[model samples]
Target: MQWIECRVHTTHAAHELIAQLFITHGANGTVLEDSRGKDFTPEPWTDIIGKPKTEHLPTDGVVVKAYFPDDGTLEATLSAVKKDLVQLEVTTNQPVAQTEILLTTVHEEDWAEAWKAYYKPVQVSETMSIVPTWESYEKRREDEHVITMDPGMAFGTGTHETTLLCLQALEHIVNDGDTVIDVGTGSGILSIAAAKLGAKAVHAVDLDPLAVQVAKENSEANNVSERITIEQRDLLSESSNEQKADIVVANLLAHLVIALAPDIHRHLKVGGKLVVSGIIKQKEQEVIDVLKQENFQIDDVLEQKDWVAIRCRLTEVGGE
Candidate 1:
């Protein structure tokens, strides 16, 4: 019951990518910290304004921590992580900024219990507040939506900007009895959010089997399993039961968003909405150009730190 906490200190250039790399190597929990100190405002995202801010926070870069097994594969896993970090530049076609990696040994219970100390309820939007499964939260507003989740080994806890933006967008657009298809539905956060926001049925898909299972579990925990269908599949794959949806959400890397652009109409009804996130601000224009070519009209854009989540609508069912 021990783990190695791998901390990567790097600029905003590829912070999320580095954290995702840790998850790919079987890391259990990921914590990303970027000191936006004096500018910290949880407004619209959280109601805890009196919350104390950390002192001496790093101003030079972001610190991303993830838990990996201290088992015999440490050397091999660490080596592979390093190699992947090096190739990030080629992967994103953007130069990887300077980075520093730190390691520490921690008992499983110590870090697992750490969530209570740091992870608090976040009001992702005017209607939704993401509460940890263990925390007992009383709604501050009658119309607020509360989503309780454990995340397990999957991502999207609503703490990340990409997920928060998507949750917020869903609050404004998802109508009662609407059908939603969530691509790259990690941890089933978006699917769960869409269901909670009144979507009648949801199709959540992920290439990672673990993500698929965790998402299914999350849907059940949220009491929305009856409304969600979890599957292990790639993006936009043709399924015998495939049906068009009123909304499609893909919180994946920017490059993947570009690749998904051309085929989006196949699964989305005309005038259906597409919510895309996990995009760094630098790649915003690149993604938008691709979507435009496919006849998508931008509707709204939300930003947090170096990340952005965009909501666009399809003007035509088929490509331009």
Candidate 2:
């Protein structure tokens, strides 16, 4: 397969928004470039501090990808692209024609191999590790641990700062035998980890069916399939009053997290814990404000590479 790379340089705040917009209008996958945040290193972390999780990722810039079904006119896509740009320029390898969009041919091998050099195994916490299928972990002199994952069709592999922060937060808040609901569970990593860490019951939900299927496969791969339940439900539009959980973890975009604040509150048992992540640093206040209105008290806030995760506890009825 061949791909056409479309890159846009803009302010950090507009990075993901722009990429998402492209995908919404029919782009395959968007990549965001880290322009202002701390550069992510490839070193493994065996020991990590636990803190609150954030709802959206704070990014300075981003890159997005979109797949073209066939040779088509670039006018529509280009026009759609222009809607998100302010002081940016667009360039194409092929000349823009009237009828079809002819993207310059890019070999899939070229793009796939480039990411290989940047991929490596990472330990998100003392007990959890993130290992990509393409690489092998080096034998350490110490008794370091590892968590093997293929990444597959999901967006998270536990290598991103946001994911690492979430895992650390999970390590701190998830108690053995507690029920956990991981919203937007990608790759089933968080849900599987929770089960491995001793959560008695786990329900993982996502809006995407493929994500649900992928998470299920990952659970089975990690041998936690029987312990975790994967479901396809759009938390934003679905009614969740019938369900309640001891812990609810939603690692999602900031806007979506805010939208689900009331639902998240409704599904939590009294005094239950809430873990929120995938938040960009700048949007932390927006999410915190939304959750606070539902009577959730912030227990801790974790920050890593400009990403934040908030750990909150639901207060008792008629109590603070």
Candidate 3:
């Protein structure tokens, strides 16, 4: 099988939108490349650290690459994707600076394994590490947790700041025997991490069938299939009594998070934690406002590389 790889260069603000456009137009998966390194400075830490130093990484643009099967419809799909992206810029009135699109053909086998060259083990938190299936990583500590994943055509490998922020929040909140619901559990990384952290049951849900399949395979690879259940479902839309959870973590777009705030709050047990990520710094307050309206109280906030993750809890009232 052959695949057409489409790479789009655009501003960081437009990266997520562009990726969504590709997925909507039939791309299986997307990869983001931003030369800017992540800098996480919790609000409380700023006083102690005297303001963390920021790196002078590239700020010009980011590159987003996606793959589509080289079927006869490839051209049409790419054209549609481009059109959607252009419309997005027009709708937002913000230019996708340095916009460029490049296409290349790659064999299935080659494309499948090409990412491995750059997908080495990544330590997202103090005790959690993401290890690609093809890589060898030695644990440096006794209590470290390793999540083995291939990602394949799924959406996460724990390298993105959004994912890292969620993982960091999960590390502090997930307790033994607690039930966890991972909305949009791409690559099943969060589900696996929760299981490793002693969650008795982890339900991972995604709307994409390919993501569900890859997440299931990753859970099995990490020996957490028994604890983590991967399913194809929208965000808590069909949640029932059986789906109520102690911790609900969602690493999704800011707009989606805001839209699902009420549903997310409804699915959580009273006083349960809600960890949300994939929000840009500019949109952080918008999401927070929605969460507040949904009766959730902000507990903690994590920021990295202009992305923000928030940890909030369902309160009995507004104070509890």
Candidate 4:
């Protein structure tokens, strides 16, 4: 399918708001690129040696991409993105002289095949290996572990930086017989990982109904269906449960993570760790600050590429 690359350039202050606005309005597969990073930092999050669950992913400037039909609607979307645009260009139809955007077409099969080239077996720490569903590996290859995952449009394929950071954090913190909950458990990777790690019980919650079904199937495929239960729960809302967990792991958007910080802390036992991810580097501090108000002690930070994952532990003091 051909894609019209609508380029919208804005300051770092407006990046998140504009990108989110466009995607919410109707833009699909929005890819954000950092044109001029003013509030950027130098050192990478996983630069420290001996950090667990650290993956050596490419270090690229802030860029988010989304896919959508090339139509006039892009103009409206771009306008909604920001009032100030140093450069605004759209690539559509036959290349016009006035348009600065690059017009490129991609066949659906070709794009899929291209991504397949990067699909390789990933050793998630020493105990777990994340293998693509379509790929094969010899199990008898001495202590090799495998978690087969095929990310079908739903995130958390164990390939992204945030997921790997979380998985690495899990390896360090998760203990046997601990009651664990994976908020936004996509493809049941985190939930299944917890089960495989010997957690006494696991609850995988997702707001999307389809994700619930997908997670259930994945859990069954990994033979952890009995241990991990997939349920629909909106963490943003207050809900009463007969049980709270010893650990809560949420790999969600940075804003949602901040908004749900209080509830996340409430649902955890004292000193329980909350592993949070799916945050871009630019927004990591915002999430950390919000959690701090709820008496969460910032424990560890993991960064891969431009993404970040944080581990926060509930302190004896409840909240501010």
Models, CA RMSD each: 3.0, 7.2, 4.8, 7.7
- The list of candidate 2 runs beyond 4 A from truth reads 1-5, 35-62, 66-78, 84-114, 137-145, 153-156, 236-241
Weakest 10 consecutive residues of candidate 2 by summed lDDT = 92-101
TM-score winner among the candidates?
A: 3
Q: What lDDT does each candidate get?
A: 0.80, 0.67, 0.80, 0.66
Per-residue alpha-carbon lDDT of candidate 1 for residues 198-275, written as tens digits (9 for 90 to 100): 999999888777678888888888899999998888777753336889999999989889998888888998999999
lDDT (tens digit, per residue) of candidate 3 on 1-320: 77787887788788888888888887888887665643333333111112212242345567788888777998778677768777887998988736557888888678557656456676668787777787777886899898887756435456677887888899999899999999988788889899999999998888888888888888889988998877788778864437679999999999999889977756788899999999999999999998988889999999887899999999985554
Worst 10 residues of 4 by lDDT: 91-100
Q: Pick out the ten consecutive residues of candidate 1 with the lowest summed lDDT.
A: 48-57
Q: Can you rank all candidates by lDDT, best first?
A: 1, 3, 2, 4
Better of 2 and 3 by TM-score: 3
Model 3 residue runs over 4 Å out of place are 37-59, 97-100, 154-156, 239-241, 317-320
* Position 183, candidate 4: lDDT: 86
TM-score of each: 0.87, 0.76, 0.89, 0.68
- lDDT score for residue 141 of model 2: 31
Q: What are the per-residue Cα lDDT tens digits for candidate 2 across 49-165? A: 222122222354443344433346555776866654432223322222112222445565665555555545656776666666666565353533355676442244466666777
lDDT by residue for model 4 (1-320), tens:
55554444344344455455555656544444443333333233222122222121213333344454665576665555433232222322221122223334555456556545555666666566777677766563464446777654333346555677788888888898998988877678988888877788888887656578878888887788898877887762533444778889998779889888877655788888899998989888888888898898998889866779999899987463
